[model samples]
Structure formats: C-alpha cells, structure tokens
Target: MHRVLLWIKQDLRLDDHPALQAALDADRLLPVYVFDPELLQPGPLGCRRLGVHRARLLLESLAALDGELRQRGSALLVLQGSAERLIPSLAERLDMDEVLTLDEVAPEERAQLDAVRQRLGDIRLLLAPGNFLLRDDELPCPVDQLPTAFGPFRQLVEQRLPVFQPRPAPARLPALPDNAGAYFASLPSLSQLGLGEPLSVANSAFPFSGGEPAAQARLRDYLWLSQGVRQHQQTRNGMIGSEYSSKLSPWLASGCLSPRRVLAELRRHEAQYGRNDSTQALWQELLWRDFFRWTLLRHGGALFRAGGLKATARAPRQLDRRFQRWCQGRTGVPLVDANMRELAITGFMSNRGRQVVASYLVGELQQDWRHGAAWFEEHLLDYDPASNWGNWAYLAGIASDPRQRRLFNVLRQARQYDPDAAYVSLWLPELHGVPQHLRHTPFLLPHLQLDALGYPRLESIPENWRPYLPSAA
Candidate 1:
C-alpha cells in the first residue's frame, strides 16, 4: 500500500479541502502539522500575531480535527519545530511517496515550500487551490497591466468575472497506521507556548469558538437568523458593535474557513431573500479580498518592499517624534486615538478604524508606512499579509493608487460616522463627557475644559496635512 503525507499549513479545515482529499486518495494517509519557529518570532512591532488567544483557539481546533479524524480510523500528528526540517524528516521516516498541500502565494510560505522540495528528493508535490475563487494566472489582466485604482479593479472583476463553487467535505477519511495514536500527543496549550491564558470574550469582536464547525454556524446565523448578509454593505463600517460586520476575518486568516464557502452561502442568501444593492456591496468587498490575494501572487516579494509593485524611486522617510505619538495613541485626535487604543487591547479593529489609523500614520504624521503595517501584523487577529501590506502601500501612495498620498479628513470623517460619539466613548473614556459636536476634535475645546477633561494639547500640524495632489507637468 502506498503511504502519503498531507502537510497542513493555513488550509486548516476539512470542508472544501483539496489537499486533504488528495491525501485520502492514497492507500494510507499521515496528516501532520508543524509549528514553524519563524512564525512565532516577534516581528518589527516586537509582538507575535500568534498571541495567547489565537494559540488557544488553534489548540482547540486541532483537538477537534483529531477527534473527527479518529472517527474515520485516523489521527492527526502534531510536531513542534521548523517545517523545513520536520516535514521532510517525517516523510522519510514514514516512507511516504507523495506530499499534498494547498498552494500559497506569499513569499515566506513559498520559501518554506521550496525548502521542503529541495530536502525531499524527487517527491511528488500536488498543489491545490483553496484560498481564492479565481486563480492568479486566470486574472483578466496581468499584474503590470492591472489598474492602480480600486474602483477600476472592482468594476472590471465584478462585472466580467464569475466565482467558482466550493467543494464538499469528505464523508470519511482514510485510516491511519496502527501506531499513529501512540505517536501523536496532546496539542500545545497557550501557556505551554509561552503565551498568556485565553482572552476573555468581553474584549473580542468574535467571541465565538474557532474551527470549521463554528465558522459554518456563523455563516448560517449571519445569513439566516440575523439576515445581516443582505445589509452587510450598509452596516459593515460600524465600530461600536459586532453584529455590524460578518466577523469572519479571524476564521479566514486561520484557514478554518474558505472564501468559496462564504461566496456560496452568500449566493444562497441572495437567492432566497432576493438580491439587493447591499448583497452586491458585500460581493464587492469579497472581490477586494480576492484582488489582494491576486496582487500578492503576481508581485511576490515586491509586496513587502517600500514601493510595492510599482516602479518608483522612493526613499524611506526618517521617523519623527510625532509618529511615535501616533503609535502610542497620544496624537490628541480622539477618533484616531480611540481606534488605536481599541486595536492595542483587543487585536481587532473595524475596517473604518483601520483606514483612519493607517491614513493618520502615513498621511497626517508623515511616518514610515511600514511601521504601522508591522504593528497591524503583530496585533490584528484577522491580519492577512496581503491585505495589510497592500492597504499600507495604498495609503502611502506607493502601491496601487494612481494619485498618491490619499489623506483622510479626520474631522469630516468623525462627523459623518461617529456623529453621536458612541464609538469614541467606547474607547476613549476621557472623551465621554465631550459633546457630540466636539467629540472628534477635543483640542478645539477651551484650555480650562481640556485641562478638566485631562486631555493633552496638540502641537503644530505636520506639513503633510495638506490634501495630496498629483504633480503638474
């Protein structure tokens, strides 16, 4: 009988799993997951995104996956080490003939795959798609030819393209070796991984448990019980509450969910409840997600550079004291400060807050955009490398935007979105007593009032505060 190994990376779920199906096609399957040390190392922000909460959820998900596999007479093997070393070593030890895994576009992940291929001599590598509905090569335009503006990209893809349907989950898995259970041990705990205890639900946007089962339940509730899928575009930018958005980013980031599954369910909702503008809006956002993935696939290592995917000569700017103040949430801008504080504590921020904080960093403070991007990588539970880097480059005027230096009018945005000061009050308690009109710009209040509120005074605005305009010929 042929022995096969399935190397699980970000594609963590059983449903719609092409790699897992390929493994089962063999006579026997050895499912393994390696915890790479490189990923656990602290990023430039001095914090690992795999914090206590994510670690705990990962352990729980692994346990569930093992149990499900056991029901089918198989068990998952968990190993703690670098994938480059561990995966090939296991393949040799088990005498496996082939290795199957979902394809990844990120540079770092691709490097890991390359290392594995080099170590294992002439081993068959089966690549499958689970990340996006459209393949990278299948995009209508090449990376260089693609539009630099989001609107044009959205228009072209949404109007002309079609999304692929998701594959069904396997009814049963292949049996494992007789000694598989004895070799497999318990998953590492949060504390065991040198992280803190599980995060309390009070602070998280997604308080639900992790794993594919939980993801499917959320999809059901969001579509059926709440019927919020129909109104997603209308309420998605909300900051005060959880129900406003789908809150599927965490699941999506961890690979517990697939975008195809989400699209399929969304179509079902549209069919049953009748299509509307809101449904189209949600589809647009999902397309944005796909667009970012395609961007990374096309550009590869260029996404991490200062001038992302663009042929421009730009020098890295010197870091200013004002930039540090923004990072610490002491910019004296209540809306921006509150959003930054929320991200620091909860590791989650609304999309509106993300854009605002990113704009404040790159546009207002004139700081190195990479610093803010690194911070998001360390803190955000839903952090996708492509989206995070792509967004920062866009804000920094280095990536996609044809007209560089997109500056957000913080005050105008505050008046439009947080007019009632609800979101501001939730994060900045000092501004709780401030009136709705002045909540966005508390520095405008009188000196004695500001002193009474315990808010700090703002210094001179930076030179970059002016609206960005294209250079004249």
Candidate 2:
C-alpha cells in the first residue's frame, strides 16, 4: 500500500498498536481521532450515555497520544463531527489507498464502522484487533459457539489460545502528505467539551492521570516495583485506598495499556518471581475481561435487552422513586451510600463496592438493571461497554450465572469489607467521627440523636427488620 489512514479509537497509545503498524505497512500515514457528539448524547430514558469524568480522561489521553506522534514526525488530527462522514471524506481528500482501525464488537461501534465502510464505497478499509487479549478470529471457536459460562470460557482460552506478542511501535513514520497539516481541526478544551477541570476527590482509590507514560508507570509500580499483583487477590476487595487495587482499569478502558501486553507482562513477572495463586487470580481477571468481549460479540444487541441472554425472562423491576434513593446513595444503606457517593464524586469505585451497589439496586430496590448500567456508563472512569453492561446484566440476574446468589447483604458486606467504617466516613460526611458500628445503621439511632448525628433516617424500612435496629443492639 502507498498511503493509509489510521482511525484511532479506544486503543489511543502508539506502542503495541497493531492498526498503526498495519497502516505503516504503507509509505504514508494519517492518524485521526473524531469526537463524535453521538457518544455524549443521552441514552435510554434520558440517562446520560457519557459522563464528564470519562470525557476528561479521553482528552488527556489524546493529548498525550498527539504529543508522542509529534515526536515521531507525525501528528494526530483532531476532528469534531460525524465520524461516518469525516473518515470516508478525509480518506478521499487525502487520496489514501486504505483505512485501518480496530474492529469493535459492540453494536453501536459496529454501526459506526458499517456507516464509514458504506461511505468508503470501493476504497480499501482494513479492520484489525487491538483491544482484546485474544482477538475474535484467534478464538478456539467462533463467537456463536463461545461457552455460555465465564469459567468454561476462561479454562478453554487459557488451555488452548495463545496470546500473541504485541507488535512494537514503529521507530519512525512517514510524515503526512504535503499541506495535509492544514486539515487538522483544533482540539477541544475541557470547558469546550463540558467537563470541569480535574480535581482531587477527598480520598479516591484511583488517582492516576491519563496517558501511556502514566499507564506504564502505574503497571510498573503495581506489578513490578511494589509487587501489588502478588497481593491482588487478598486486597482487591478493599474500598478505601489506591494501593488496595491495581488501579489499571481506567488506563485499560482507555486503551493506554494493551490487554495483550498486560497478559504478557504478567507472564514475565511470574517467570522472574515464581508464580503463585495470587498471580493466577490476576490472570483470571484478564480472562474474564476477554470473556466479556466475546459475550458482546456473540450476543450483539441482545446484551442491551432487559432480559439479556434470557430474552424470554420476566421484565426487571422498574426504576421507581425508591430506586432514586439508591442512585443518590441515600437508601438508608451506609455501605451502598458510601460507594455510590464515591463513584459520583471521584468517578471510580472498588469492584466489591460495584457488586454490592448493583445487587442492592436490583434485589432490594427492584429497579430495572438497565437504568443502573446506564448510570455507570455515564459516570465510571474505567467504564468499558462490555464490562460495564455485562457485569450489570450479571448482577441483575439477567446474564452470566443468574442462578448464583443475586442479592448482596449490604450491612454484612459493610462489616466484612470495611469494618472500620473508614471508607464510609470519607464519603458520607454526616457519619464522620461516628462510631464504626454506629455508622452502619444510623437509622436505628433515636430521632433526636439522628438529628444530632446529621444523618437522615430512612422511612421505608421493611416491617420485619424493625427490631434489628441499632438501638436494640
């Protein structure tokens, strides 16, 4: 090929970029990132589809990407418009022989790709795999035949599939065509994008900035330097601090770090410092991530349905006003409130916290699971379409091991995971300086004391649970 256009998406980094490598198979390359406003539009029932936190992270990642490309005598063209029109039009204007990009699995993503392809008519467009640890074509069987259970999928992939070595970034790139720089649209600022300046949450667990250097640095600290990976299984459930977990999800979701590279590095870490159950547990998470990718591929639009894989199943509970309390973290559940408030303020949350709140929404509040999923899609910093929606469906008992225990005992979870009440206190300031056990059930406090404590009592308590109040204890 003589010339090509590299359509960068979630895989924003230069290193280990398969699409970029294939584009460089030609003599000239033009890299472009389009800010499709469609992504930011409201989703079902007026739920926000994209939140400011994810948007800010994307901007930072892109700025870093463009800087790296510039150092290599190339640049990332920033455009704000419909990608379906922009990509095909730009390819024709630049006279590129081919357009290259990652093949997305989700329907919305595929729709965009299809639109661009339809517009390209007769132009060569190539799709490559950049995000998953094992690409779709590399799977042992086709997507349709993928195992329904995560355990089966993980076992089969681990035993049979090979995670190929990631392609290294090209040392140099052919510069843009003459005067092609003139086509560069000015990059939008945070304010222009409707996001406020990034600020520190009072006590966030994931505080890292966006970009490749940050991602690599974090990986090194978490796995190699600090050996956090060794203790991952033991501490990943903790809800308070950054070091409790790897904190790599934000970077992984944004594609600053390649999934294949993460898996490869894990293997290298095990090689250097003998393998253990903890490292295996970490590897299992990577498999789960890949499994969700396959889930999206196999099910396509079905995953978005209320019943998910079980389309014939009964409709999920509606998002009632009581569910509104769950969304605001004020459903008289200390643990749920803390986690929800943390997510609202910091744009992050612990995995254990996620499972707990998700279960609460579905099992206790009887809210439709899709509404909660949409909220996560809007607010989570590390939100990936497959993982966010798939997990939500799983928790709501709509997919992925629905027979498993569906409801979370939020009080039990609070005492078990955060006995000190330290995590709760940080997010729910009304309970700050309160006793550890007292924070868990403030509603049980006497009305006068509840007022003194500055916490609101939940009026919608179930009748049978009244005697189990804090005062009785």
Candidate 3:
C-alpha cells in the first residue's frame, strides 16, 4: 500500500478538490496542516502577515475541513512549525510514498515548496492547480499570451474559455493508518495562534465566519434563498449594507471555496431563472479575479516590487504622519476617512470604497502605493495577494493597462454615492448628527458650528477650499 501525505495549503476545501482526490487514489492518505510561524510573525510594518480577522477565519476553515474529514473516516492532522522543515522531516520519518498539495505561484509560497522538494530525497511531489476558475492548461490561450489589460483579457476569456465542472466530494475517504490521530496536536484557536478574539465592527459588510460549509451555505443564501445575485450588480457598490454583494470573497481568498464551484452555481441559477444582465455582471467579476491571477503568472515577483511591472521608477513622497493617518482613518477627507475607518474595523470594504481610498492614498496623498497595499494585506479578510497588489498597481498606472493614472474627486464621489450620508453615518457614527446637507464636508462650517456638532476636525484643510465655506474666516 502506497502511503502518501496530503499537505493542504490555501486550497482548503474537500469538494471540487483535485489534489485531495489524487491523495485518495493512493492506498493510504495522511492529511496534515502546518501552522507556519513565519507567516504569523509580525513583519517590518509591525503587522502580522496574517491579521486577526483572517486568522480567525482560517482557523474556522481548518476546523470545518477537519470535521468533514472525520466523517469520511479520516482526519486532518494539525501541527505548528516551519512547513519547509517539518514536512520533509515528517515524510522521511513516516516513510511516505509521496506528498500531494496545491501548486503555489507567489515567491514566498513557492519558496516553501522548493525547500520541501530539496529535502524530500526524490519523493514524488504532485502539485495541483491553485483555487482559480480555470487552470493554466485550460486557458483559451497560453498564459503568456493572455493580455495584461483587463479589456483584452476579458474579451479573450469570454470569446474562448472553459470553466471546468467541479468534482463532487468523496463519499468516504479511506481510513488513516493505525494511530494517525496521535501524530500531531489539535487545531489551534485564535488565542493559541498568538491572536486575540475578533473585533466586532458594527454593521460589518461581511459578518459571516469562515469554512467550506459556510462558503456553500452563503452561495445558497445569496442566490437561491434570497435571490441576492439577481441584484448583485446593482447593489454591489453600496457601502452601507450586507445585501449589496455576494460576500463570498473571504471564502474565495482562503481556498475554502473554489471558483469552479461558484461558476457551476452561477450557471445553474441562470438555467433556473433564465439569463439577465445581473447574472452576467457577477460572472464578469469572477473573470476579473482570474485576470489578476494571470497577471501574477505574467509578471512574477514584479507584482511585489515597489514599481510593480512598469520599468520606470516613481518619485517618492514623505510617508510620515500623513501616511499613518491615512492608514488609521484620521485623514481629513471625509469619504476617505470613513472608508479607511470601515476597513480598519471590519476587515472589509466595498468595491467603490476601495477605488476611492486607493485613489486618495496614491493620487491625492502622493504616498508610496505599496504601503497601502501592505496595510490591506494586514487587515482585509478577503485579501488575495494578486488582487490586492494588482489593483494597486493598476490604480498607480504601473500595471499592464495602457490607461493613464486616474484620480477620483472625493467630495463629488461622497455626494454621488452617499448623498444622504447613509453609508458614511453607518460607519462613522460621530458624524451622524452633522446634518444631511453638511455630512460630506463638516469642516466647511464655522469653527464654532463644527465644535457644536461634536465632530472632530479633519487633520488638514486645503487653503483654497476654505474661501468657499459657509462661515470660513
């Protein structure tokens, strides 16, 4: 009997899991999850590589995966250490026939795989696809031929591409070898992982916990139960409420859910209810997610570089208190401040809000773009390395797109998007009493009036802007 070790990474779910299925093909399967200390350690920016919101979500996912494995007569073995060393040592000690896991593309993640391979002594390493909607070989064109500009990429994908039908979960996994449960410790809690309990942000857009079961259930609730997908495109940009979007990104980011599974469900929805623009729009966003993933393949580690893929270097600005205020949501700009506050508290932000905040950070503040990207990496629940950094690169005008740098007019955006101050007030309650008319720019009022409203003054005000104020001196 060939005994193999299944080393799971971001691809966390069991259903539609090609890697997990391959492990079952062997005579014996030992599933293990190692909590790497390097990832949990604080980075130079003083934020853990994984923040509390995402850390808690990952723990939930592991628990759910383990529960499902137990029902199948197998269990996930949880260990804590450097995976590069621990995995090789485990494979050697157990005399495993092979190690099966998901393939990684990012430089840091790929490094771990390389280290394991060097230590495995010719052990077979079967790496499957990451959690992408379409695998590399399945692409309509060679990945290198895939366009960097989203328009061309989307055109090519929609014109000629196939989304693989997801495979069903196994009815029953083969039992582990005798005494496999004793091999490692149980899954760690939020506290055990050196993190505290999750911060309960009031009115968080994504209040759902993590795991495959939750991921599956959310798909049902959003589409079938509530018919939310029918209006997803319309309300997706709204910042105030949870009903606006599908909110499946957190699951998608962690690999608790597969993009193929989502695609299959969207197809079924169209078949049952007939086709519509809303359904098509949702499908397009998934393709955008695919576009970012492909960008990583095209550019490699350049995605992490300060200048992104553009060969030309950008001039730097002072990244001192101003940058820190932007991160902390203390920026004097009302819309920018509210969005930043939302992200800092909730680990989530709307698509529209993301664009506005990104524009404010890089275009208006003139700060280094990578710093904002890193802060999002530290805080966002649905943070995808490619999407987060890729979007930043695009916003900074250094990405593959031929477009020039774009800047959002924040005050105008606040009026158009939050005309009644509904979204703003929800996240920034201190400004709730600042009247609907003055909500967008509370500082425009006289100093006495601003103080009377109990709202804190913005960190800075533009000199020219004060001349037009209602009671400016």
Best by lDDT: 2
Candidate 2 yields a Cα-based lDDT of: 0.82
- State the weakest 10-residue window (summed lDDT) of model 2: 397-406
lDDT of 3 at 341: 85
Go through the candidates in order and give each one's C-alpha lDDT: 0.75, 0.82, 0.81
Q: Candidate 1 clashing pairs? A: none
| Model 1 C-alpha lDDT per residue in residues 286-399, reported as the tens digit of each score | 778877777777788787776654532252454777776776788888888988878767777899989888877766666777777877887777788878877777666642
List candidate 1 segments past 4 Å from native.
Answer: 44-49, 136-138, 141-152, 155-160, 201-203, 311-316, 398-405, 433-437, 445-454, 461-473
Cα-based TM-score, every candidate? 0.89, 0.95, 0.93
Backbone Cα, N, C clashes tallied per candidate: 0, 0, 0
Which residue window of length 10 is worst by lDDT in model 3?
A: 464-473
Q: Pick the candidate with the highest TM-score.
A: 2
Sort by TM-score, top down from the best: 2, 3, 1
Give stretches of model 2 more than 4 Å off.
398-404, 452-454, 460-472
Candidate 2 lDDT tens digits, 219-239: 888789999999988888988
Better of 1 and 3 by lDDT: 3
**Candidate 1: count of backbone clashes, pairs at least 3 residues apart or interchain:** 0
